[model samples]
Target: MSMENAIFLQKNVGFCNALKRICIEGFEYSTLYKRIEKMIADEEKKEEKNEKLLVDLWECNLLLSYQLDSKMLSICVPCLLKFALKKEEDEETPKEVEMALLSLSNIKFYRAEKELYLNEIKEIIRNHQEHHNLTRLAYQSAWQFLMNRSLVYRDLKGIVMNELHFAREVGKELEEFAKCVDWKKEKEEEMGKETKEKLVLMRWFHVLFIFFGLCNLWNEEFIGLVGGIAWVLRAAKENHKKISEKYIYLLGNAAKRRDVKVEGLLKIGVVDSVLEEIQQSTLNEGVTFQSCHFFLKISERLKEKTDNDELEEGNRKATKMEIFEKLEEEGYDDTITSYHEFLHLLKVNKIDFDAISLDISEYFVNV
Candidate 1:
């Protein structure tokens, strides 16, 4: 079917349900795979002149992706990889590239030739990380593959480092947002132009989400990047709630890591930022839960470090008392008060701390 006809069917009978029904009612994988192969062969014969056929095939690939299992879909991995790899030698359509990546992203269960396909996927990510229109989809696919395969942390270090570098570079736009002294004026400006600004804001949030994924690796290089964690803290203090929630998630992950030294987080004021979010009455429950969990983690880590006698006196002070003193030096005395008050409120209300801890932890588990 053409894209238009498929969209019409989707509109009439919800896309996923329609696809499921098709899958149930004798949609033969081998036959469909042969049809797609024929289409690809035809397109290649014309030297990529048939954009319409390629698009229809892309739509078919997308439809196939919703199903959890398909042998032919597994076999089609090389063909999808071919589309992705073509970007290196010749310019490809942005839609085709995105569809190819999205198709790869949807293949959650891998059955065929894991190492060969994984190396190809990694090459796609490395070569196209700089693509103007395709980077986000590329990263999304990489995240999917990494999560599904249970790949080692080392497998993703390069991608994580690349994303952090991108975050730091694109993060410069956030400085203007950080410098806005009047929250009311900033809110007004944001609301007035929200339609145009929404895409840009979402792009930034995607970058932060990628950072949240990296925190699972628990790499010291990510934590120790000069302005990496600081940029996230600054974002948490800004006006956007979605962006702030992502920052909270990144902070929560950083605090949860058992291997890395978290002093960089403290020096960058992650504690103060989490406290600020918790004290806010207007934030969502998800944000509040993450902030409280982050607070608890930091407090626990501090206690653990304080009890360790192997550390020198100055190191102890830097990790414990002096960090809070740094908060005071930055004039966050009220923030500290609010932090204490929120903890007291949690205790008094008998809020299940265990329940709150899973909100962020569960998200990372699936990712």
Candidate 2:
């Protein structure tokens, strides 16, 4: 057979194979891939005819084969839908219309995921305006790949949700980054807020790396860090005790109790309990407490000691039991494990924490 005829046959075969996969072997995705691969090999074995045609055929087949496994339910979805939609418009069959609708749904799902990604992009730029370019490209590339590859799958709900969640998560990080950089705008001092913020983010990234890095994402290293954040949170709570009481008051409760003063801090309410003993101090007046939702921690103060400010030279202890109980109450243990994993979050963005709550509230209320 002449090269032209052979090439035409191969193209027809490739198209037929793809069509069969979609129409007949709908459930047999594995078969579709195997068939495509085998056909490509057969086409490659034939004698060369038109170099350009061969390349085009090879590329088209390769693209199809590559797409067989590549899932692009979010990015390439729209294009796939457009192709199907146009076909439905031309052929005008009920089956074609149904397929077009199904493809439309697939595209919509991916578009939702892409929307999530776009939201994340905006957040990255808004937060990390300084280093925004770097992350921006990363996000763009991911989205572009999503668009370029046509790998729409039947099960894409999870993919879209994950993309959205990832965007939300990454946005917080980038916003923290932006805020951290903005803090140094006026200081003109060494180790400006930018540097410290970078350190904080890097530290969190380290935790992410450790979590994602190590074979065991669930390592003890994370717990320690979470413990440390808990400790800081504890201190931050104490610092903002007075103001927290004010907010607590706003919650409109019947619990107005008292406790012994530590470091000249006049305390109110019960100790080692969910009821916060408000200590009169400056920090409290500005920031809202993280414990507003009940600050969950695994550590317990093993005999609270009086430190003028910080919890130094104090015997505070944490065990898996205490941590687990507190986290269980808050329902975070199910989502996360290990102190390091938790602490790594704080290591990333020092904001959206108690300190930031204070600053943001203060910014709006006082500043």
Query: What local lDDT score does residue 294 receive in model 2, on the 0 to 100 scale?
Result: 24
What TM-score, to 2 decimals, does candidate 2 have? 0.21
In terms of TM-score, which candidate is strongest? Answer: 1
Cα misplacement distance, residue 138 of candidate 2 (Å): 5.6
User: Over the stretch 146-245, how does candidate 2's per-residue lDDT look in tens digits?
Assistant: 3322234324323322433323434344344434344334245643233433333332332222222212221233223223222222332443243234
Candidate 1 lDDT (Cα, whole model)? Answer: 0.52
Error of 2 at 175 (Å): 12
TM-score of 1: 0.60
lDDT of 1 by residue, 1-367 (tens): 9756854453334223321223333332556545665765677679546654564464465545345345555545666676666544345565456556555555444556555476777666655545544544444444454444433344555544554343443344344433433444657776633332333344344445545555444344454432444454455454666656766766776676765456766765666666565545465656756665575566566656444465643565567776567445655444445655766797899987566543332222110
Q: Write down the TM-score of every candidate.
A: 0.60, 0.21
Per-residue error for 260 in candidate 2, Å, reads 32
Stretches of model 1 off by over 4 angstroms after superposition: 1-65, 88-92, 129-133, 151-220, 224-233, 236-238, 275-281, 305-309, 312-314, 326-367
